[model samples]
Structures are given as structure tokens and as C-alpha cells.
Target: MLVKNISVVAAFVASVCIMPAQAQNNTIVVKANQLKADIQPTMWGVFFEDINMSADGGIYAELVKNRSFEFLKPLAGWTFKGKERKEGDLLILNRQDKQTNNPRFIQVNPNHTAKGDFGIINEGFRGMGIKQGLRYDFSMLYRQPAAGVKVHVELLNAKNEVIGKTTISPVATGKEWRKLEASLEATATEPKGTLAVWFEGSGQMDLDMISLFPGDTWKGRKGGMRADMVQMLADLKPGFLRFPGGCIVEGYDLSQRYQWKKTIGPIEERQLLINRWNFEFAHRPTPDYFQTFGLGFFEYFQLAEDIGAEPLPILNCGMACQFNTAEMVPLDQLDPYVQDALDLIEFANGDASTKWGKVRAQMGHPEPFNLKLLGIGNENWGPQYIDRLQVFTKAIKEKYPKMQLITSAGTDPDGERFDYLNGQLRKMNADIIDEHYYRRPEWFLQNAARYDNYDRNGSKVFAGEYAAQSDKTVSIHNKNNWRAALAEASFMTGLERNADVVVMASYAPLFAHVDGWQWTPDMIWIDNLHVVGTPNYYVQKMFSTNRGTHIVPILKNNAPLAGQDSLYASASVDKTTNELIIKLVNVSANGLQQEIKLDGVSKLSGNARHYVMKASGLDVENSLKEPLAIVPVEEQWKASGKSLKVNLAPHSVNVIRVKHLDLVSFKKAGKME
Candidate 1:
């Protein structure tokens, strides 16, 4: 009769249907299933630096030269005393000398006989489009005959109006070069402008290696990415990464685009481009700028390999109307774009025989990279986009039939855009469809079940960009409210439930330095002084870290609990250690105390490991000043006989691991005891 009762329970679980809550009493009972746990790596994606903007004199993503100065142009009253050399047709700056005679002052002097009119006119730092309210760290080397030089700095807006001004007193010594630094705060009154480094006030000073940066702090523990940053990300054990995106792919023009080729090789040849958010311009006449592709396609692919992640590269889509989208290249003129696609593949999976593949080998690795997925473009739609996508799809499929292709269609839930594009993609046999979402926390929670009924027969899904808003201003120190935590948790549960369809997912705008951020409420916020991970980052880590490879069926028996709206459970058994891993999610405002009874297992033994995620309140958040306001904690659980009872805090997620004792012989153990 007991066995018969268990069979009936299994049948009931198979027929369980999910429905919306009518009343508050929503509860479910779960029965353990005997299945092996399949452990897989976690998926955690972030954006690497894109070379679309210039931060300081040194290009972003490019290597910093220890001591050197690259002249942009000749100043108004300055003449080049040295010969200019031409490498090919390009004019190269070699070396120039300034002839001045009025008692050349090496350092600044408050009371001097002359006004130091011999200063280099226009021989100053140019802005790379820095805007107001953003923070930046500016550093340079000042060498003079004596110390005590007053360096004047000015930030000029696009209108040529001085928006910010500051003066620094250099710690001078007459004998050697001294390092000087000043932190600049962009003001609301300052529009997008250029930065100028003025060495005025009666001093003959030699300036070199002028560096400016935005963000609260540097990324790696040391100044640059030597080994610390790599170790930190590796410790997380992420499964997959979606490289190079979140508006960095969408440039203002073709000339300003992120050309992957330029970022490779040495740093000197790479040109710096204007940042889109900084509201600054390149040299004037036209807004077109150069990007020193220091962090190129190879680096992105290598980073994925180093971190044990599956690389998912996103290509440039058809041009936008604002940035001058190239007309659908006539079928005849499509060679260039098509060739680019081919080159990208070769670079990723080509052998030494191939051109780009040979380059990869020359870069140090002789083995071909494993690349199974390729994204057609960034966020794009419309008829023109569709047509261009078709061309790319045909070419890529013809070359590599087994390769997976991912495409983007606009995300308009209310309208038929996603549905319509989904249909088209299915018809064309696309492997995956990239979907993005950025909304308020309430909306995310309200639609947590949006993918529950998604067509299983359609292409796989990828949530490319989804973030809860905190602030719209440029400052990166803003904190994410507590409501966001609850909302994100609920939405993630939905993603986990639909893992079969949602094959891959990632959060957008992964990092922002307090001084140089264009967006707010990022996952990781850093400044020149410190770095902190947001509450959302921890939530993602906990969920991804505990995920198993395969899905198992669970049986729940609870009827209805007061103040509870939904209850769910998933379980798996680790083969190596013979431990049962169980995850329980309760989306209720009140706490839940339930007893889990395992009837079939007679060999169950050992302590249980439990991990929990919860918050003190709904509106709490971790600020720059206080980053660990909310995080996950681990504890042990007591198990007696075949039943385990545990208490779950309100609005909490819990994972428990129960060890087994099949390896221990009862008779032998009893004799020993």
C-alpha cells in the first residue's frame, strides 16, 4: 500500500500545471528523484574595453609608454626646428627644438621678472570628449631646472568656454624628473569638451606621458592587467562569455567604428578615437577619429580561452541612419563585408595554412580555436537589416554548415516585433535569437513567467542585455536599490526553469569606473581609490555557481500556505561524492518552515550543506561607501533518519546538499562501533 501511494504521487507530479495565483495560498510539495548530477561550468559575461574612445593621451586598450610624448599638431606660434620624416605618405613627428632666450625658467616662480611669454602656444593637452559630472584621474611627468612649478589645467567645452579650471603646485627638485598628478571633477555646468594641460606662470617645464582616466579606480590590483584581474575572474569559474558590446559596437560612423584589425600588434600604431558618451570630438573638421586597436579580436578570443569560457563574438550589423548605414551593398559590392566575415572565422578556427589563421599561430598558439557560435550583429531590425542578415547568413552557412548563427531582432514585447522576427528566424533555421531587456524592477518581477510558454520548437534564446536602472546620471558611485534584488531573483528563477530554451544569458554594462562612466548602476563599480561589487553581482554568482547540467523531475505535495504565492524545488545527485543537491525557491513575503521526507532512500547519511540569499528589506542597496550590505551565506543542516526539516527566511533562495553512505557497510560499521 505504501509503494502504491508513492506511485500515485509520481503520477500527480507528472501532470502538474503552473498557473497564476488567484488567492495568496500558493504552495507545492517536492519528492526526491534518484538521478545523477551533471556538473557544468557557469555562464558569466562582461564587456572588455572597446577602443572607440580615447581616455587620456594614451589610447584606451593600448599599452602605456613609460616616458614619451606624441605631438598632435604644431601650436599656433610654435615652429618645428627639426626635420619631419615621411614614412610612406604619412607625416611622422620626429623631434623638434624650441628657441627661447628670456632666462629660460625650468620651474614655476610666483615672483618673476618676465611673464614667461616664451611658453609653447597651443602646446597643451587636447580633450578626447570629456563631459560634466564624470570623474577623471590625470597624471603627467614634469621636469624642470628647479621645483615649485604652478601647473594650470583647463577643461574647455565644445563652445570653447572654460568649464573647469584648477592649479597644482608641483613638488619640484632641480635635478630629476618629478611625477605630478591631479584629480579633475567634471561639473554639470561643463558641456562636452577638450582637456588642456597648461604649464604657465614663469616656468620652463618639459611634459611627457600625460594620462587621464575615468572611473572610480583602476581594474587590476596594480596599475595594469599583469596577473591580478585574470586570477579574480578565473576564481569565479564562469562557463561562457559574450564579448565586446553594450553600445561599444555601435559607433557614430564607419571611420570611428571598432575595426578589430587595428587593435592588434604594437600599441604605438593604434590611433585613439573619440568616446561616444564623452561628448568630445577628435581634431575638429570632421568627427572621424582613429582607434588604436590594442584590445583586438584576438584578445577577446584569447580572454575567453584563458577563462575557460565559450566565446560568443558579436559582429557589426548594418549601419544606422544616424551613423550613415551603407546602403545594402549591391550583391556585386558585398565582397568586402563577406570577406570580413570569412576572415573572422579563420581567425577563430583557421589553421596555419589560412592567412589570419597563420597570424593567430604567430601570436603564440599553434592550435586552432574552438568556435561554435557567431552572432550576426548587435541590436538591429527593420527590412534593410533583415536583408543584410540574410546575406550574411547565407555566406556563413555555406562556409560552415555545422556552426551556430545568432541574430538580433528588436525587443518590443507589446508589439509583434519579437514574435514576427522569431517566426522569420525559425523559418530561416537560425540557431539562436538574442533578446535584450532593460526595465524597472516591478516590470521584471511582473513578467517573470514570460518565457514559460515559449515555443519549444523555435530557435534557442539569449538574453543579451538586462539591467535594473538605478540612476541616469554619469557618476558611477550610485547604489542599486533593494527592490532590484527581489526582482532579479524572481526573473532568474524563470530563466533557470526555461534553461532548455534559454541556452545562454548575460547582464549588460558589466563595469563602470566612478570617474569615467557613461552609464550608472553597473554590476562592478571601481574608482582610482577602491573597487566594489554590487548586490546584483553576488546574486548572479550564487545562481550560476549552483546550477547543474541536466534537469530532473520533482514531486511537490504541499497544498496551500498562508501568505505564500509560489513554491518550487529542483534536485540532483552528485555521482562522485554520492551527495544529493536540492534547490528550493519560495516567492512569498513570509517565511516557510517545511519538512522534507525521503522515503525510498535507506542509506542516507552525513550532514547537509546549505546556502542562502536574502536581504533585510526590499529597498536596501549597497553603495560605494557600503558594498557588502547584502550577500549570500553558507551553513550546515542537521539530518535525522530519512527526513530533513528546514526553515526558509522570507523572500529567500536556498540550496542544500545531503551526503549519502552507500560506501559504508552497516554490519561492519556496527561491529566496529
Candidate 2:
């Protein structure tokens, strides 16, 4: 049935009804020849933050928990047992002076002479997932004071039966730490398996950084990211990846900030720190949460390279998280923090002869990553941030003038703090300004034209971290539902329409473990064995994969079609493929029967394809049990001449791609035929 709202119909007729032959003004006219602006290649991207167990337990893929024995409770994830007794066998040793960052290591001391197999069993993050025939790499740092000390490693199933086993014998009786490595092939598949290490010797031994990794990691490198999670990101073909962010870049305190230098280098040597989200929320208190830096700066850059994305790494400014400690590094002692930014650029794009570049080469990636963009801070505000940012920009531009820096505009999209920072950034002539928004679905829907009047000549905008909140910001009840995703899609059409002003955008908190999450509504959610892409993920994928080169004017009647009869539209043409990609969003609860008229184009081929993502209900969500519940549905479409009637489903995002054929050339070819 046609929508009968008087205001809506009149608005549609006043804008869309161009030809008198058509009685109703229900057509969307797209000016194929009128190029509006050039679409940015990095307009759509993904933001990754370490909140919600995203790194350690979600995507980094290390199977051992508390690997460095650095958790507040050193043996939080491990259970000790002796062959005869279960008491006072395992001890945590700490060396405050030598290993300040990693001060603790587990030491196993049997009854001095009566030990069959006394060791500790580790319950991995929720439990390790083991598959038959797959190889698992196990490594640990060990030191023995006496000879004949052996460490027996085994992968055990849920039923307490061993599926894989390896042994590491420390023959040298010295205090020097020696690295032990072994690989175990599982004989059976188990989704919630555990790792057991038994020490059967007459001597005491110390171990630290007990680690296990799947051999089939992304790029097949040991101590690498999970293959499945990275593969999901790679499939999106994102133009850029914004990494190590949200609040993590600005730690709860200055000392806890995300230090790129500490995150790089060897995995074992990387300092372990308590994650800010460990006790942030009362609803989900994860005391075991910590940053092992296993998925550090190098891995983030590597992941970006593997996925064909430009690396946009955000560094910490002098000011810490404003909501927490709001600590600030003294201006006199801020050289080291600024130096980290300079060194990071070298590590990413410098030659092997450079100091930082040598570290990158030693890590096995000899080639530079060709870094172009760097973010100065996460969501910082106030004069302190501005002072620090001024120093950073002056120093960085002095060295690398061509490098683009993204400055922050506080947290809220439109407030006193945001206004102050935004104005200051513009006055400072910053290359790009990053803005974040975590608002309600209705707010997103209403703000579709937020940037329509932005100053195009000023610094470009980066919708750095944004996700439509279904319930409330940081609320446990907030969900990644179709409602939020649909609203975001609508808002994104506006962003694409003003592509010249909005250079880059990404969704926040990219990954979340279903059971270990501190934040809700992440793009992707995972469990012990399965990964699920939320409706928001598909929406982002649709916009990114189909993003064309240049924008074409798409109008309903004489006005831009933004929230007209609950419809939003944007069209762009790909110079490479000569294809017109038109995106449409129907926010209304009822279906839309709209005719799209192509103008100024002499001919358009009948060949077309429509990629759509719609959910049955607004509150519906995708889960590991039903991962495809809200995924894209592709269908072949045909257009006659320059007009096509499209039936857009309720609350849906559609990308329609049609071949733009040259009519004059086609006619000449037809005459020869």
C-alpha cells in the first residue's frame, strides 16, 4: 500500500515529481552525468579497541591465559595439583629489581623426592578450542637450578583425557632463562580443552610466559593473530584500519597508557599491564583481564598490511583518559612520549638502516609498511590536550611534512568541550580532525544531515569512533541490533554524500567475546569455537565493498533524498568499472515501491545487481548459533532503458550496481553488427 501521510506525500511530490506524465511523485531521479564530488577511498573503515576482551581472549588467539603470571592474582587462571597431594606445591616468585614490568614467575617444587607428575592446569580464556590434525605451538621461558628437570605439556579434552602431549627438558642447571619450544598435534577435536603442564623432577624450576598458539595463524606466523578473526576482517576489504584505540590509547592513568615501544619487540619481553576495563563496569567485572601486548603495534600493522588496508595507528597524547584519572604528563618531561610518535613513523615506513626500522626488520618484516596517516590521541579534551597536541604537530611536521595527522575533537559530537577543540583544531590548520559519537538510534537517524553544511575548505573530518546505541552509552543492555545498524546506514549515506569533507570513518569496539565482554554492541562477536558478524558488520561491509570512486547527484524530485518518506539515498560511479553504484536505505516500517530514473545518461545496460541486508525485526541480532541471521542477500537485477522500479524492504540497506554503457559507442557497434 502507498504511504498516505499528507506531509510525506506532498514533500515527495514537490521534490520527485518532475514529469507530468507520472501522476505520483514516487520516483528517485539520479543525475548520472552531474558529478558532485570525489569519494574518498578510505571513507569506510573499522576501528579496533581492546575493551571487551577484544585482544587477548577474542582475536589475538593465544590459548594460554596469564601466560606471564602477571595477573593481579598470579595463579588466577591456573589450578595446581600434586600426584599425592594438592597443597603448597606451586609458588609465585617475584624479582622487583630485575623484572620490574614482569616481576612474577611460577615455580613448581615437588616433595623434593616423591613426585610422579606434579604440575598446574590452565583454564584458557573460557577454554581453548582444539581441532584434530591441527598443530599447536607451545613455548615457555624456563630456568632450573638442578639437572634432570623435565616439563611435560599436554592438551586435555573436557573429559580429562590427553589429546596432545610434548615434553621440554631443561638440562643446564643455571639461573639463566632459556626458551623452550615444542609443537603438539591434537588427535581429537575439543572446543573447551585445557592445557596441563607437569613437572616431574627432583629439582625446582621456574617458568614464565607460558604460551600456546595455533600454527594456522594469519600469515602462518607463530605467536600471531587468530586466522579466523583476521580472515573475517580481510574479507571486508577495508580501505583503512584504525587500531589500538577508543579509551585504550588514553589509559586510566598516564603510566598505564598504550606505549607503542613497550608493545613492540619480543612477545615475552613486552610488559604486561592491567586492562582499564578489568573493573570499569560493575555488571561485568573481569579481574583476569590484562594486556599481554601479544597483539601489539607490530601485529596491528601487520594485520593492516595483510588485509590491504592503510594503517591508522592512534598514539597516546600527554593527557590520560579524562573520565578516569585525567592525569597529565608534565610538559617538561613529555619528550619521551613525543619521541614514541616519531619512532613509530620510522618503524612503519623507515628503511632497515634506521634505528626503529631495525627493530621492525628484526621482527621479520624487512619491508616498510608505507604509513601515511597517524592519529595523535583517542578522545582527549581540554587545554592540556591542546598544549600537548601543538607540541606534537610542530615536531612531527618539522620532520615529516607530508604525513597526515588526525587530531581529536573531544568525545561528545556537539558540546562545549567538542566545540572548543574543533574550533582550535581548525584554527591550527590540522590536516584532519577526528570526531566520535555514541548516541541513540533515533539520534543517528535524525542526524543524517549532520555534515551537510560542514566547511569543505577546512580540515577534513574523520568519524573516528561511532556506533548507534540501542539502549544507552556503555550500558550492559545496549545491543547490536538491526535498529542500530539501520540507523547507522542511514547516517552513513549522508557521510558519503559529503565525501569531500568526511575523509574517513569507522565503527568503534570492533570485536567482543560473547561471554567476556565489558562493552556491548561490537561489530563482531566470538566464542570459544565460532565467530559471528553482527548486523552492523554487514552494513559496514555493504558500504565499504561497494564504495565507488566519485559521487553522482542522486535526488528525489528536486531535493536530496535524505529521510524523505523514511528513505535515504546516495549514488557514486566507479571509473574503473564504469558502474553506477546507488545506495538506498528505507527506514520506514513499510515497504517502498520507488522508481529510480537515470538522467543525462544515454544508455544503461540491463545488467544490474542488488546487495541488501535486512532483518525480520528491529531488535533481532546475529549470534554464533545463527551467524547468518542478518547477513547480506544478493540478487541479479535488470533495468530497462533509464528507469527501474525498486521495492525496498523495510529497514534495509541496499547497494544497486548497474553498468553505465556509452550510448553513442553502443549504437556504432550495433550498426557494424
Candidate 3:
């Protein structure tokens, strides 16, 4: 075949024969004139879960752990620093029969006690992240039965040296609990800092909901998300935000499943539940782990709005986690669960006059969230899930027909569970089917064409959660390395190529705390004072930011480049920006010279914006100390005669954007689309 007129790779040898492994075939042809499919707005997003201390001790900005003394071990995160006193001097009283939601409170009797003689220090979740000159706000529910009560607060570093100080005198003397708040500015910065409270000149005071937060929280909201953590999410410019999720939506038992109703309204009223991840590993016991619901449904919705992302909240169906309790509610008793789903839609998009919508307004969100997608379950399988889902589907559709429902394909991507659920959901004409995968890097590369032949008619696909496991699924040794990131980039090209079938996709297990993680290979890692976006995160950012308005075919030898010669490619044209955006993922460990032919092109900008990210080594990863070690490097490249001639670095994900002069001029002399 002669390429005198038709633009093709310079060295492109069209062959049906199978190329040897890692062969050097570096040819890619992007058909810019033809638009295949419209890329959905919610194509790439983020999946949030509360594992690895990502909630209570994480994104949730409450720095004080066990602030309400509600953990199983009532004083787990606290310590009595003063000399031991007689019985009844300090007591943990439970009002289980009265305040069922928050039944525990600490009572201190300091009759004739001098200042600094008795105090309790909170060893925040792995220590609080304190910044110099940043104000630390302290608040607690207190009741004083007598006069002469003063509370002293201090912030300490790792060496137990106080860097900040404040005092609170609860003058409200009565049996009823009253909320008291105060703020103190830190004089020094310490990533690992502690909060201490001294009971001084007190007759008797009962305290509950002892909380502290940094003044620099997101938007400076009193009790909002951590600024830096939320900034990482905002930086992604994500299409959607799936929240209050992962396994927490399907708890260890039905009795413990997340109840959205209980998570709304006042912070004091929000019921606290033991975190499902509490002490899962005997070797690394975290008995104090619990969900304070500080980051609940309202907060999740607000966060989505804050980050300019569509809210996709998954609710708890009538069944518990199949991997654990495998509990199910009788069909007759599933009414409440269905009602919860119906009410959530109202809470999100209902008018302010409606019941749940009023709750949204009362919570400072006067306008509706206008949520369009909702899921009933997360990773559940079997007929039990299907049955419960049937009820939920009927109810939600009847109430809000326009609302798109996401049905689960279960935990395994290709097991009997997935096949059965996938078949049933399609038969039911489900709007979207959620699929999850956590496999080796090779699996990702091999399955680069996963949705190539997926039916474009009925139920669309939602790659709800996926990660290329560096080791094995659920293995603590798995790392967020460059190899895994490259594989994911390769796989993602298929998702972009098949934009007609897969409407939504996201990377799973969004965050992990370096000191308190139970899961590895998270998109982002955080510690007391820092946030690190992994190489995988950079890949996501590169693709998402460059995601064009519509899909365009980028083929090699008239075939989609899916792992051939370890090169994967997808092309799109951004109608809004009048630019041709093409992504190339090179999996080889050695650099390769590549020629990209822009078929049916005439005139274009001389220089194109190029974003290239390459790992120094397969096993190398970004860390707290070196956050930008493997980040994308944005540069410019000059094109030659409407074609790009560039060298793709080994294990690199490259994005090239060429500005078109006009729709007509960018194509062949006689061609016009």
C-alpha cells in the first residue's frame, strides 16, 4: 500500500501477523476529521472511601480523636497525664438510655485542685498537624454544677513541649449541656502535635464532644474538610465525586450499615458508629477507629458542589456486606431502605418546600444539589442484592424517573458474581452497571480493549473502582508505582476510545494515611502535614484535563492500538477549544521514536502543548518527601508538516494538543466535516 496521499506513520508496516513481545512498532494515525462519539461529561471521576484513616483522622478536619469519648474504649485517644487520683475523681458516664446517639461523657471532680495539677492530653489520630500562626479552634459541650471552673488548653509537639495555649471558663452553670467554643493561635509549627486540656479551679464539670480544628480548613468552614486534602481533589478537576462509600456503605453487619438519615443535621446529633476498618489487622490494631459522621451526606454533597463535580452518592441497600455478615432484610421490611433512596433524591434535588429538601435548606444549602445519579449498593452480589435492588429501582424510578441508577456488577470483575449480576442488570434495562477491578498490572495492559465491543444500546458501564495492584488484590505490599500507573494509563485509553459505552470511570480508594493505612496503592497519600499525589494520580490528571469533547479514532495500520508493540493510544477533538488532543501511553522501558500522522490535515499551529510523564524506575513512587518526583512535565513541541515527530519516553504517558486553525483548514484541501 502506497501512502503518497493518505497520511500514515512513516515506518508503519501494516501487518496482520502477531508482533513479537515488546517489538518496536511505533506508528500511530489519528483520524481528526471524523468524530466517533461524544465523550460524556462524567467520564473520569474520583471514588472516595473511609479506609486507612481517610475519614475521622483524614479528610474530615476534626483534629481531636475520640472527641466525644464514644469509641468502644471510651478514652482510647486520651491519656491522664497527672498523678492517679481516687475513684470518682474522673469518671466516664454513659447515658445510653437517654442520649442514645452520643451516650458517653467525661466528668471531672477537681475540688480545691490547683492549676496544672490534673489534666488530660489527647494523642490525636497519630498526632495533629499544627501550623505556625494558624489559629486552632477548641469547642466542647460542657455543664458546670458549681462555680469556680476554668479549663486550660495547650498544643504540644512531639517532644511534649507546648507551642500554643488557650483557656475556657464554662460559666454556664446548670444541668443542661451547653456548647462552649474558643480559639488559640499556635506559635510554632509541628506536624506531630498533641492537644492537652487541664482541669483547673473546677468544682465539677461534665464534658462531651470535645473538638478542635485548624483555622485553615477548606473555605475556613468551622468543621469542614482538611484544606490540603480537599485541594488535591479540587486539583483533579474531576467530572464527578462518588461518596460516603466503598465498604462503609455496606457495613460489616446490617445493624452497622451507614444510615444517611443519622448522618445529617447537627454534629452533636449525628450518630457515631464504629469504623468497619477498626482493628481489622491483629498485627496493627486500631481499636479507636470510628465514624463520627463529621463528613456525612450533607458534607459529601457540599464537597461535590465545592469541587464543581456531579454528586454520585451510593446508598445502602437492604443487604449487608456479602463478604462479612451476608445479612439480608426481609422483602417486607425493605420499605425503609427504599424510602431512604426516595428521600435522598428529594434531599438532593427536591424543592425547598419538600420535607427532606427543607432539611437541606436548614443545613445552609437553600438550593437543591440537582443530583442526577444514585447507586443502591456497592460490590454486593447474589439474588439477594438483585431482589432488594429491584425494589429500590422501582421505587426510585417511580419517584424520579430521570435519576440514573447505578447497579452493581459485584466485587469480582469476571467471576460468576459479575456475570450473573451483569446479565440481570442488562435484562432489567439498568441505566448504568458499576464494575470494579483490582488485578495485576499485566491484566490491565492485556484488557486495554475491555469495552471495545461492549453494547452501545442498553445499560452503560461505570468503572466505579479499579486499580492495578502492584502485588495482589488486598495485599499490603502493593505500591503506587510508575509501572502500575503506566498500565492504568494504557487501560484508560480504551475507556476513552469506547466513550459510547463507558459513561463514567474513576480510580478507587481515593486516599490513605501513611501512618494509619490498611490499604496500599491509593491515588493519594497523606500524613499529618502533607499530601502526595502518586504517579497514578498524575496519569488521571493528564487524561482528565485533556479529555476532549468527542472521541476520534487513532489507529495504527487501520487497527486500534491496543497493546501492540506495548503502545496504546486514543484521540479526541475538543470542539470548545478547537484543538486536537491525542494521548499516547508507551509501556516499554526504553524510549522509542514515534511519528503521528494527522490524517486529512492541512494547516495547524506550529507548536503543540505536550505533557509527558515518565517514571525513573518501575518501582519508583512519589512520597511525602518528594511529592513531584514522578509528576508530569509540560512542554512544547513543534510539528512538521501537520505531523508530530517526537520520542516517547519509556513508561511514559504523553498528551499532545495541537491547535487547529479552523474546522475546514485542518483537514484535506477538498474535505469538510
TM-score of each: 0.67, 0.93, 0.95
Better of 2 and 3 by TM-score: 3
Model 3 deviation from the true structure expressed as Cα RMSD, one decimal place: 4.7
Per-residue CA lDDT of model 2 for 511-549, tens digit only, reads: 998879988779998887788889999999999999988
Q: How well does model 3 score by local distance difference test?
A: 0.86
lDDT of each: 0.54, 0.84, 0.86
lDDT for position 179 in model 2: 90
Residue lDDT tens for model 3, 393-418: 88888878899999999997897888
Candidate number with greatest TM-score? 3
Which prediction has the highest lDDT against the true structure?
Answer: 3
Which residue pairs come into collision in candidate 3?
none
The order of the candidates by TM-score, greatest first, is 3, 2, 1
Residue 556, candidate 1: how far off, in angstroms? 4.6
Candidate 1 error regions (>4 Å):
1-28, 31-44, 47-232, 280-292, 321-332, 412-414, 470-479, 554-580, 585-587, 597-603, 640-643, 661-673
Minimum summed lDDT over a 10-residue window in model 2 is located at: 664-673
What does candidate 1's lDDT look like per residue over 312-387, in tens digits?
Answer: 7776654432333443335556667666777888888999998988888987677877888777766666566677
